[model samples]
Target: MNTLKRTLALVATLAMTATAFASCGDEKKESTPKEEPTTTATPEDTTAPEETTAEPDNGDEIDASVKTGGDTFTIAAWNHDDVPYLIAQWKGLSFDTVVEDLADNKVDGIKFIDMNVGGGQAAEKYDQLFNEGSDLDVYFCEADWALKYINDDSKTLALSKLGLGDSKFTNIYNYTDEIGKDQNGVRKGISWQAAAGGFAYRADLAEEYLGVKSPDEMDAKIGNWENFVAAAKEVSEKSSGGVALADTLGGLWQAFACGRTQPWVVDNKLVIDDFCKNFADTAKELWDCGGVTKNSQWTDEWTAAGVSGNCMGYFVSTWGFGGFFLDAAGGENGAQYGKWAVCQGPTPFYWGGTWIVVNPETDNGEEARDFIISATSDEAQMSAYAKAKPEYVNNSQVMDDLIAGDTVFNPTVSGNFKDGQNYFKKLAENAKSIDFKGLITPYDSTIKGNFADAVKENYLDGNKSWDETVEAFKDKVAESVPDLEWDD
Candidate 1:
């Protein structure tokens, strides 16, 4: 038989066998923590909810042998490598290894392509590829757009279809599994990193302004929105109005939106829940106190806030800590390099994550499956991941051991950063508190952007009242999702 034809037959056989194991009890969903402030679920709600590993024997556990006879396969994602620490730490023994092993002809004739969908164009390209059915064999689905893909089985296939036992994931974090699964508890994707977030603050500024720079003391000060505002007032008073409490207005919204009590669209109706309304109030108060500037996120000004000491800090997740935000915080040797600390500021909110998914349309499912398992589930690879880099990995057991200092991933004190404090402890605590089980919607990207714009224009800059701002918001959301229904 031809190689392509044989590949299809094998994948079909594997899918059938995987479905036979579908009844595994470990598929039981984790109950969303009732006390979580980020989301209040009603069963049908879809909530929108990182990591590295090196390979010692990952190939052994997952049988990471490359399938030689399949058609050339393509995987699309936002960057060259979303998580560099993992790739760097692995030193060529991971998904990278699998691809290398195959590309080097150690295997057979499989063609692997890493489609670098530029950061700004990823969502557009992903949607385009699905619409055109352009051989999207493997792809990464981000948290904001995950629900859309999960619900569309045309694009995603359930992992249980591989007949892999839940035993493979006993150590996985409940939230990771929860997000990857559809409403029926069948997982279609998986992540290797836990992108838990906290307030990344200038420890020096905390002491200079709040009179205490340590996380514990600072945590007490900006523990909640009210306390945060009070601290902002202190900043305005002390910095002679030179520094704002937060880096930008966008930072405040980033933290606030995660604390939302319900999805933007609940039950086919556009409802503004308590959390949404509270943002208006909180933003207004911040404006009054000079707590936040109008700078947008990802802009030069916003990035400069962390470095210039013009603002106290940023609300960034573990990914930000490992790359983006940390890089923005003046790299490892920048001025203020060692003056940073993180804490659970006011809520348990996840900023970002990338889920590994397979395109059901591919003739390479078997190979795709092995890649997913190697990157996300292989124990040896995950274990080596911790020692190579300091990431809040997704495996609960792995994270627990890492938290207890099981790996060589050490927090450096050379520069006296946070006084050599281990920030992973706080990261683990914050990661566990997340419970956005049914509060996700695919349109979050649109709604979140519109809402932020509405607030910035009407309330912050134009002097519109909260009610007027809500009216503007409704007009905007209605335009974006014309089919959506909202209550008066």
Candidate 2:
């Protein structure tokens, strides 16, 4: 097929596949108050105007008309599972500290509103809160959700206007330039945590079976995809096909497919470039080498394989490493504790992290901004980190502290937590943000469905040739993002 025709065919295939699995539903809601436009200013200066009124001494005494009660700052977030680290800390602290701290500071209340939404429901809930002008103070959303909210002009409050502009978050901007700026060079969102992507392995197994003594040596053996494959083969051979490198396909695909040039789509066109193909091919090869497990269920497969000590390692996000794997290793339900380690993979990729945004319609816009700044400040960030180390963003000092003080060991590598942190930090330095405009088209849900099916067909179904898989991806993209175009 000619290149243009080939590309078009691929897009069509992906589009059809994506739509098949797309969820059809809207998010539910809890009632609140109406919102009024606080103030407006030029994009150049986003902070709100200073208040002439003296700060209230009693958090409860603040003007109810403006602030949402000193005791009541609602946090809109997805499922309780999304922020495990935060949940752990909050639960461990008995939930009183969050309230008492706010009250003691003369702040009224704090409420964590769980918006049990997932997949497409998440997107819908986000719109309801921001687009529809619902009354919410703080929004906790993933990168994809954050991208959509920030682009919608009416929904979000610009951080710069809250006096957090350039000065307060300089360190965040410097660490990852992508999060600090929007498409228009405007600062829209701030990362609350950094999702450093890497490989988590069974260190005890490596040492026992493969004679791998340390993380540095193991990392050297599987430094990149090519090396990783070789190491996987060694592990498989050593273990007599008892332990594979990964249990699922999605994690590995994400690790290598994400690129710096652009998102999965560009200008309404699907982008099925070398990156995607390479990732698919790598996965295919690993499957062939008996380096991957065959279970399709994520949590179940992860639990069974992890606890059984049946896999060499798996690709995971930084937070995932801390929350999921850590629990698997140490918790009562955990079976792999003290047997794992972490290492950076071939490419730098981020899976999940949240951003906190303000509503422009809130009456206490200035106060809201200050609150955001304080919450994300170095002091607060460090405190949050101390309580829950989920690879958070903001304040380089806090990140440094977490990395330096971490002692958790990864099962994949033969070293302690510090070694894994260094590897993850290095990968984070090269990580890039997802460009919402480029990747998420009107048919985003459809595209995701098609892509998921295509992956299943190519990987699970009878062996498909590389060319055939590429052709399928191209067709899928064309169908899902018909208006999308690729720049020559």
Candidate 3:
């Protein structure tokens, strides 16, 4: 077959195969760590003024929004931050617009249904819309659960359907491409940011405790797991139990899960590799060593620890730095604003990310294509995005500019987490280390959770023996996923 025919044939096959997810009507919700947006920082930081966004003159004008008979291009998510990205990118404005405009469908000449559901409740709503054969235009999928939807051709439309080609995705991280590709290798989605993680530590804490003077010096104190533990011991002993090493158990869990080399399941049977066991042992070790604070994840206490200068640092992805870490440090105006720095912690693992997905049958195809391309592909918009925040944006070209050592840091983020240093240089290097080839599974969310539960039961609490804990975990997994095959 000729190239066009071959491409068309592939698109048709992929669309049919991937639709299995929502055929009975459901889109995938996040099974991965949820991204905390830069909006979470504070009242002032979240709403930077409109006059600040200076559009780059890179000369790539995206095609106009879909001109329909007043049809609103509906996009849904569980949060309130994503829609503003679209509107701002479209209007080429600074990070100043009110998200309420999209929420209430008040933007002129264009209509939008920026429906946001509460956390953990988006899946059911997506299913309801799909079941009712709604005209949903664009949506998002997270790293952990994206496969559930992307592997279903019948439920999703390939970006090719809107004239997008692989060329548009050339600069995105390879792992991102691996995750967003359909089973047949057709690209189905694109993530505008790369969620590479690092160690966000208090420069003051590192210096006061370990005498580590810079991010590089601090990295040596805990660059690997062994060093990390040794450093935690040092932190505990030196602080006289005044400071805890762990911000929370979940932070370590995020780092460990993504660095796995094997699948959680192999041929329908569960496989708890050495790394997972080590993760369990290590989590408990951190807890016992008084290496962690007692505050729960996302609690005000946990977040406040960073600003109050209590917890040492966190293991988080790129978004974590700009999102939670940025919030915890307080915005530029807060006390600990410029005191935080990032380095590679224990292992290089990615955490959360947002990928844009589409509805093939919607009438808003042009708008969808334009938005995706502008947000992800157009260099001009990406440059603007990088200039607005220190996210490890998916585009390498922009990242190079960001790393140029002084020019690309966003002025709006006056807190300047890295103190004008391109910390992403380390992140960009670390991004290359991730390989998700055999690591992911459809049941990742449940299996990962159960394993953590088992660890908490056996190691953390001692309520169950190791073997008993594992078996109970297996039992729970079996119940949640009836088809999960055992190793025997």
RMSD of each: 11.3, 11.9, 13.1
Each candidate's lDDT (Cα)? 0.63, 0.52, 0.64
- TM-score of model number 2: 0.71
Q: List model 3 lDDT by residue over 343-426, tens digit each.
A: 876666677677888865567776787788887888888877766644567887778776775554655343556466566776
lDDT of 1 by residue, 402-435 (tens): 6687343644422435666667677777777766
* Model 3 C-alpha RMSD to native: 13.1
Off by over 4 Å in 2: 1-74, 79-112, 130-133, 173-180, 259-262, 327-330, 380-385, 388-393, 405-453, 478-488
Count clashing residue pairs in model 1. 14
Query: Residue-wise lDDT of candidate 2 within 243-357, one digit each (tens)?
Result: 8877566566555444323344443445554544555666677787778777553566665777777766767765565556554454433455555666555554556556776
Which candidate comes out best when scored by lDDT? 3
Q: Tell me the number of clashing residue pairs for each predicted model.
A: 14, 53, 13
